[model samples]
Target chain A: MSRPLLVILLSIAGAGSIVLALVVGTYPISVLQVIETIVAPAPGVVHDVVWQLRAPRVLAAFACGGLLALAGALLQVLLRNALADPYVLGVSGGAALGALVAMLLGAGDTGVSFLALAGALGSIVVVFGLTFRGGDWNVYRLLLTGVVLSAGLSACVSLILVLAPQAQVKGMLFWLMGDLAYAGSPVYAWLILAVLTALAVAQGIRLDLLAAGELKALSLGVAVTPLKLAVFFGAALATAAAVTLGGAIGFVGLMAAHAVRLLGVSHHRALLPLAVLLGGSLITLADTAARTAWAPQQLPVGVLIALVGVPAMLWLLGRRN
Target chain B: MPGVLSCRHLRLQVPGRMLCGDVSVTFEPGQMWAILGRNGCGKTTLVHALAGLDRAAGAAVELDGVVLANTPRRRRARDVGVLLQQEETEFWGSVLDYVLLGRFPHADSWTGFSREDETRATQALETVELAPLSARRYVSLSGGERQRARIAQLLAQDPRAFLLDEPLQHLDLQHQARVLARFQQLVRDERRLVAMVLHDALWPGRYCTHALLIYDGGALASGASREVLTRANLERLYAAPLAEVSYDGGSYFVPHV
Candidate 1:
């Protein structure tokens, strides 16, 4: 009975996203008009502006946001630490390093994507390599190693920024901040497909099995090494894809997962998929705020996540305590 | 229905010190046995080696007449239950969930809790009289309740043999009586083997079918519990006199004050 209640509430919340997205700009469009614009046509620039400019961006926001949140949830379980975030395990630092090097080399957008991905993959592998004991990596050790690796990668990034040409630094700076501007149809299609696939794999009570101690889980016949590898690789690939598209939009992963738990649900089977959807929605909301909070000069969408997510997470963890 | 387990030429050491080496022992099934030793005398170290939870030198731990590999012996874990001291606080789960972990060696990946699994888990909890507190968080359990839950988990495992380290640790007089009574019933009714490490000499003499006394990393004596648990031997083990006392249908020993 209670399970069904969460499902229904989520459906209603899904409908609300359209209204919230359409109604929030300067020269705001009404929900009725936005619906009509979708169904029919306004015949001029509003049609192009609404459909072309805002709609694609909204979907992209949700996609990347949800991806980050799901990644956070998975990493938390795989690492066996409740405080784990998507970027905490050096995943983000590696991506940033990849994107920065690519930019400096003048490898445009595709190069940016590939390098960021390579960085994320490398960092995840490195953390796993350094910390693995027996068939598993202890979360506390992984976290410590990650924090150290991330700091090292970050320092390298700063060194590159200092040494690089001015033009390269500007491009690197933007990629580091992750804007929702360039994400159009092709990026959205590829990104959403990969994310949904990873989400489908991560969603289940099997995730609860990760909460079981390693010895107990092993005794239960869990192929522990392969399971950890699957989770780690899946979450890392999805996260790298997000960084490839959205940059280092901090706290979306942390907030989205934390928010769902704060809403009085702890079961990962329910929390994960919802975290994906709610994560997407939250990032979309942050993107919306980033757009509307200033007229033309825009804030990095990552800033809005920090602003909203910090208080929200603290409140959630506090309330739980 | 007796199962034979024998260890031969076993050795364990750390750097310049030898904890236990060139030692051999065996116990037949359907009998209760006790291992007694001094502090840092390799009692726990020996328990871990015998349970296959730790590696040993020059010996292999065999179960049911087969020499199982260390990794695959986890499959054999369903037959051997162990209650290491203070294992609960290191992890999180409910009392019910903690006991349910006993059934894991039978499970595969899916985390499925079948009806039979729950039934066995419930029966085990009932044996320890912890059924009413099944829903309580594991951390919230009292010292006695935690001990009861651990024993219930061991019972639920339906192990062929039980290997327990400090099995009577962290219980008051009343709770200790309850646990020991259950232990006695298990040995008498089920006629299964139990190898437990006991700090107290009285319980072993009253409950154990066989006893082995160890001090300074060597066996002092071992035989039928009554013969092995004598005051003279206890005095030798503890290096002091112990006042032996007789109480209602049971015998106890204490310091003469």
Candidate 2:
């Protein structure tokens, strides 16, 4: 497919998934009713259900998915490792630990979000400090440090879970599984997603060169250190924002990037945007399935993402092989 | 002052091993220079240091009499292009798209690839004789095809000096001659300096105007090829006895064993 056509198709798919998510909840609102709820506001239960409840949740899912996938793509290029994802560097683990600590302290949603971002930033700094030496960024050291740090953070999370009261443990588990009930407003996440996507697209060509290897990028006159720093921070910020909004969602970050590449979107300019669109659509569809698959008993979107993403990724790899 | 690329008090070392020490060389335009040395004798390391891809603490490389460290990376890239010894096999894209990356230093913006850039890339592919594989995935190409594709990328770069490490690594004899001849032609017609690290002594003797022999723990002998590539120098550089035979008014070194 041509680039523009693929972009248009992805956009349509994204919009269609969002609409389907908004309409396919337990209340079973028609498409006309969904449109009516947005266009003409009525002071009724339908308005309360769609506008007050479902809209923010659906938009949050879309924004979080886009953020995760964009971060995944940037890290994959920065590290030149195909297995890299948003959480590969332990950013999500730090966020989860921070959110859990806040939850244990009886903090509100905003407090938890702020702490999660802080935790994610802290993890980035630690990983960078530990892995960087003598002006060289060793990929193996960085990968190992991040993975070990993530394991340490997971222990902290498990400790928090074991110590928390029984009543709060269920809520904590749901949040860990990426429950979107507490994603109050999608505005902040969408703003972050837009800004980071713009930045990534702006540096897309450099990302391509970096993927070829650091030596190749340097020889080609790319400011390798500065570009790597930008990608590192950009991906960290995006991952933090996504985890804050949607908890520690998995699969979308890792799989969406590979899926777009498998579909023949090679250049980062097209790859980044299409990855975002595909990621957003995947989570929105998964979230819709999570909510309505067993109505009134919502499954975490992370579970559904893994269920869907694993098979899709396996098929992609299988076909490529 | 005599050459476009010159280094002073050059030194390269890794941990306990010294690759090159106190080596100074000047490379002028309109010359094809070859660096010859045995395996692990720092030939690749020396080329990388000259290209500013690796700079030790005291080593200073100057391009056109300006300090290479002071030049911005993008501007330096406009003047010098280095083709690495090993090509990364993990990159995913069309061969043309990969070559178009050479236009990166000239690109106006991050997201833009101009018409002129595409023309240069296409012309480069044609020059390397891989125009038919322009749309093929880079990872799918054979070793020789990939080497040619990279040569195309360097040609598209069109830098003032080309520093290539093992430019003929994977190519068969025919392609090897073809690529080296292209570099030789570039030096002759365009006055661009082409310096490559070569394992074979025969091709450098045939195609190079100047040669640098690295031997015996950071010792270097450099001058015109006919003066520096003597049979004795070749023996010391490789640590093997060589039989020099003149063929077609040129010398070729063959191991005596």
Candidate 3:
């Protein structure tokens, strides 16, 4: 797709999904009613539902969706594997472990988020330490470390849940479903920082030569050591932010970025930017469907993404093969 | 400083393996030197060590006597260029874009490209006869066209020395000749030197000034290509019948299969 066209489509689609999410609530409102609620003041019931209730929820969905996509895109570039989505291998598990431990220690919701970020970053560092040393880093070792760490975190989350207070434990269950129910615009503000970090990652498309294999990237002056460090940290941090705030949303990164690459866009320079736009738009649409499908009650946006993305991806795959 | 490259006491170790042990060599300004060897005899390893891409425990290599090992990375790139074996054509860039990546070392930190760099890159593409295809996407190119684009990238780097590993692996005979002939001209006109590893001996005799046959473990012979490629050496190197026949002031080796 042309860059301008992709951008235009995303803008139109994203705006449409957000508006649709706001209007199609339990007590459905007409387009004029929704427009008036947004632009002017429709006092009383319509006003409360539009501004206070649905507005925050929709913004949270957008933010979370964007974060998942961004994280996934960064990880795909760093790991050099199409199958490597943000939630795959264990980054989300690592962050969830951090949040779980903090919550167990009586930290507030915000503190759990901070803990989750720390946990994700720490696990990445540990994985690097365990796997990297000699001339070429071992890919299999890195994957093994991720799997082990993920399993360990899952165990810890389970153990803590086994021993926690009933109220706190119940809260953790809802949080783990990857929902955007209690989330709002405040979390969206934090996600802006995540997107900025992704913008920093935009510099890393110079790494395509490195992805061709190490020596080639270096010959092109991509500085292999520095690139590895920057990519690992950049991808991991972006992923952590999403996992902490949104829970582990599966396959957003893996499927979307790979789909972009499968379209014959091999270089990260064009591929990452396109993947970012597509991922953000896809998540926005998915979140809109999740909220409006059941009126007053909301299905978790993460589940909705899986339900929609998988079938769409399979169909795309079928067309390709 | 005027000629191609020089090497002294280079040793390379990999965890438990010693890839190249205590090697010293120097390249004349504008000639091709061929290193002939078997699979594990460390031809590519030696190339990487010399290119300064692989960190080794050996002695230093200097490009134009600048001690490239200690020089800043950006400066090192300005002096040395390498053409590796792998051909990854799906770079998602135009022929111009891929070739221009050779100019990356010269890029200013912020903006990343300069007009001078673009001119050099376009000239390089022209030199490789890829100027007509500059706007074409890299993925759309055939293998031979992609090879020329890669060579064009190295040319744009405009280094004093070229290090290539298996440079003629996949090309047709015509492309192989074009690539080799152009490389030979780099010495005559520009005084740039190239070090290469070839699967055949006749290419070095035809275009290279120096031929160093590495057999068993180390340098077997080093001199002008004609002097170094003897029938006795060919018998030992390939363990087959090789007759050196000469015609029209050129030499070719024919193997009896």
lDDT of 1 by residue, B1-257 (tens): 55565566666556588876655777667778888877777776666666665543424656666653343644657666666654512334457777777776664535455788889999999988899999766767888778888888878877767788887888788778887787777777887778889898677877788887776756547678778787888888877778988877656677555
**Candidate 2 lDDT, tens digit per residue, B62-86?**
9888888778888878889999998
Worst 10 residues of 2 chain A by lDDT: A312-321
Q: Tell me, per candidate, how large a share of the native contacts it keeps.
A: 0.09, 0.64, 0.34
Model 1 lDDT per residue over A198-262, tens place: 45444343555455555444433345567677777777777877886778888877667667765
Error of 3 at B246 (Å): 1.0
Error of 2 at B34 (Å): 0.7
The candidates' interface RMSDs, in order, read 4.5, 1.3, 3.1
- List ranges where model 3 is wrong by over 4 Å: A15-52, A98-108, A111-115, A134-136, A155-174, A182-205, A262-267, A318-321, B1-3, B13-15, B57-59, B87-97, B107-149
TM-score of 2: 0.96
Clashing residue pairs found in predicted model 2: none
DockQ score for candidate 1: 0.21
lDDT of 3 at B62: 74
User: Chain B in candidate 2 has what TM-score?
Assistant: 0.95
Ranking by DockQ: 2, 3, 1
Candidates in order have lDDT scores of: 0.72, 0.88, 0.72
True contacts kept of 3: 0.34
